[model samples]
Target: MDKINLLVTISIIIIFIALFLSLFLLTVKTAHKLSNRLFAFFLVLTAIDISANLGDLLAISLNMRIFISSFFFLQLPTFYLYVLSVCYSDFKLKRKHLIHGVTFLIANLVLLPRFYAVDEDSKISFLANIKSMPEIQFNHVLMHIQMLFYLVAAFMILRKARKIYLENYAGASIESLNWLFQFTVALSAFYFIALVKNIFKFTEYPNISAGLKIGLVLFELIIIFWYLYKALNNPGLFRTIDSKLKLVQDIILEEKNSNQFTINEKEHSEELLKLQHYMMEEKPFLSSSLTIQDISVAIEIPVRDLSLLINHTLEQHFYDFVNAYRIESAMDILKDSTKSKLTILEILYDVGFNSKSSFNTAFKKHTGYTPTYYRKML
Candidate 1:
């Protein structure tokens, strides 16, 4: 390998280690059982992806044909894992997912004969001599078909994730889901790009193999490692429709009413403090795209708990609670002792209100007057 490839490989190894450690510590330290389990699933699948490819790049005592043959087997499971990990919602284990592994094993059985032959002295030569003659490679065709299924499965996951992210505009886990969705989509696209470059190598495309290896394979390693880093370091990158899902699941699984179960006031205060900090320092509310989910992520709280706390504990709904803060800040801005030349509209957005109409409606709802009337009174 060239020095650049060596550098790239080392960097990816470092990142993979970091992700593994994050996954480890998160698995151990997280009090939330579901989060810990899902994170473990993420780590296991990512580890499989990395480990399968590592045999190729690292030293091994296998002939080139044997190495290539094993790689073909390895690639199947790696792609299957990519589909499975991104599709995972609940941390619950399923027996059906085992079928993918079974199929991968069965595929190797069919492929094993062609790639390995017992020589006259019973020594196995793991090279396909059929390539020297015009011969039908039926199992290769079957492997291609299996790969297509993996592609379809991954694409289906991407579609579902996209729909959930788009439809759950009000919910919080959308951002996390979006991160997984984008990464999945990007990885799939890169794989397809690689596939295309592989196909075009014979069509007068000079250096197509090199281009595919560099742009598709090595870059895939980099992107997937980066993905692990993001997902491990920021567990929020795995999006579940937490509020709705929790409500549904809670109805089924049920929670015991412990009289001792009280809202943590200190944690609540800390979250509100974080929200206040965001409002003061970030001004995210002016974006109109802002929602309770966004705040939950920003505050590092579960959306289901955040919603319940906002409604039952705070005795306020999200909209009223947030708009109150916006309006109060706007009030301070409007009633400033210094002469203010900016319009009420400018002040509204400045205070994180998305529009003049929303600002006016919110001000009137809170204090029984429009901004103009309130400003005149001030």
Candidate 2:
């Protein structure tokens, strides 16, 4: 019995030491301010949590009560703040958000007396709460309620996070963010489940001591360090090109090399000019998913220069460039008496538009009329 106790004490201390180091390292790392602040809050919670466990191990009932009270009380506030921090884009913290914490505090305070442990007759021995008969029920109905609060906060974070980074390359970054952010949510979920399980086996598994609870807290600490390390490594997210100057440098270098290569391939470049002949004679732009880059590649022209030429000569963005071809093809289709029998949607699909909505949107934007209206007027 004494041997088991000693090992538990030593194992817990080691975990707390790592927890402190992770927090210290996180403090020094550069990050988005809201995430840093929220993570710091979690670090503080870990410290309190460590104290709660250590207090119980020491059998210092007074210290243990203080630690639990403080941890649980502050947790109500940190819960929503952590969510706000994770999902925060504008970094605006409002007074209204405090209501979530305040509401929890008031509810907890009202039920505070029931939290103290009952005398020996009661079965809830591990946690000395208001479980004593006649005074208050031992069952922690409030804890279950708190679990609901946690779920709501975590779910909100998950819901809001989906929209932040929507660019083609941002999917991986979002995945990484979800993995890290989900740690807190996952911990809360485990704690809740273990708690429910504890209630069911309250008599038999007193020895188990909520392994999942301890594990979740430990996991939260470890997750902080892992996230902090990744944050430091990725000053800018992977492949997202965090530096504007780097993008400009790439564009200039690419254009310079394109000009040099074209000069070297003068005869071949002259043959490449056959693209104009093909577009006029073959009308290949009628194909679906054909963008300016596809055309530039086919004609052996530098995409950047082709874009430059289009912008200087035609004053249009790439989106508009593609749509112009689609719209012209739609016009050509409309002119044929046999194809006139085809529906506007069919014509749009035949012209390579992947969706009716997209076809209508692009056609209207380019030709100042919806496909149906354009066909009607023509």
**Which of the numbered candidates is closest to the native, going by highest lDDT?**
1
* Per-model CA lDDT versus the true structure: 0.56, 0.54
lDDT against true structure, model 2: 0.54
User: Candidate 1, overall lDDT?
Assistant: 0.56
lDDT of 1 by residue, 1-378 (tens): 574465457546744764665466465654344545544454444444444334445564433334334344445445445444444444344686566565446645554444434343322333334333221244445555666777677667555654433332322344455565566667567656755765564356746654565565456566656755775576543444322333322322343343434557888788767767876787655554566678778878777666656655666656567677778877888788673677887887776664455578779999899998888897
Structural RMSD, model 1: 11.9
- Best model number under TM-score: 1
Angstrom error of the Cα, residue 336, model 1: value is 9.1
TM-score (C-alpha) between model 1 and the true structure: 0.49
> Could you estimate the TM-score for every candidate?
0.49, 0.49
The reply for model 2, stretches above 4 Å from the true place, is 2-11, 14-26, 29-31, 56-64, 76-79, 111-130, 133-139, 167-172, 209-378
Which stretch of 10 consecutive residues in model 1 shows the poorest summed lDDT?
243-252
